[model samples]
Target: MKKTRNTQKQDYVIDILTNAKHTMSVEAILKAMPIKVNKTTVYRILERFAEKGKVHFVTGEDGKAYYALCNDCNVKHEMHNHIHFQCKSCKKVTCLPYEIEVPELKDFEVQETQFLMIGICDMCIS
Candidate 1:
């Protein structure tokens, strides 16, 4: 298998997501980037990553998308059966480690599921 090389901007974006403590929005990613990258470029990279199963995104309560690196995903299959929590006070999104069982639907196909819980995080409570 030939592993394609990543561009400078792509490398930067991956590094930022890899080191992030929680999921980040596109705007937040752009702000954290050291080099100048346009919005379209960031969106493109993130989309590609998601397609390749390297990253995943969740829609927050504010209707904004937040991205985070995938822990156990691959190009063949991407499974995210966990909860996504957003801190209302800090406005940070995190992929909780807990897993939830998806109920079987009769004569219906379930492709994906997202469970978003909005509340004040521990940091804000302290």
Candidate 2:
């Protein structure tokens, strides 16, 4: 398959984030990118990543959020019932759904769920 420039950027972002030790802000992403892209373009790419279950988001204490990769095996993460970790110290957000479960409520039929966890990451605390 032919790779589009946007796809290439997306892949670059993913790889960079995967190896990164801290959450990447928009400025960080833009500065690290080899290609010239505006803030809107970056946000658009993130939105696509979120929709595809490739990334998850979290708001930090500063009210600025970060995105992390969503790892799943058999079941695709349908934005349904998952937990994300936001370390207070390092400010890195990590997706950890094992600690959380889908809410069981008879009153409502859930279509989409996003569970997020915020706390001190190991790297941050140690």
Candidate 3:
């Protein structure tokens, strides 16, 4: 696989996501960027990251897409079966460490699975 050159903006975006340690929306990512970057550019960067298996996205409870860095994904395969937790109070989305077993089906092949748990987080509970 050909590795694409990352621009300054792309590096900045990756930094934001890496430091965040949680899922963030496009608007949030734009706000976190120190330099001025257009929305289209951010979207394109995220698309490239997804293609390279560096990042993954999930739809939040609010119907907005949230992005986060991939833990064990690569260009050949992108498999995510871990749990994603969303706090109802804070509306924060985070990738949980626990991985659930994907059940086998007799006549079907499951390509992807997303397990989302909606509840209050530790901060909110305290």
Q: What does candidate 2's lDDT look like per residue over 1-126, in tens digits?
A: 999988888887888678765567776788888888878888898888878787766665667657666645335456434566677676666655464556668988776665556687787677
Which candidate number would show the highest lDDT if scored against the true structure?
1
If scored against the real structure, what TM-score would every candidate get? 0.87, 0.69, 0.84
lDDT of 2 at 66: 71
Better of 2 and 3 by lDDT: 3
Q: How well is each residue in 1-126 modelled by candidate 1, as lDDT tens digits?
A: 654434878888899999999999999999999988899899999999988888888899999999998866522335577889999899999988888777879999877677799999989989
Q: How high is the CA lDDT of each candidate model?
A: 0.86, 0.69, 0.84
Quote the lDDT for 107 in model 2: 89
- Cα error of candidate 3 at position 117, Å: 0.8
Q: Give the per-residue Cα lDDT of candidate 1 at 21.
A: 97
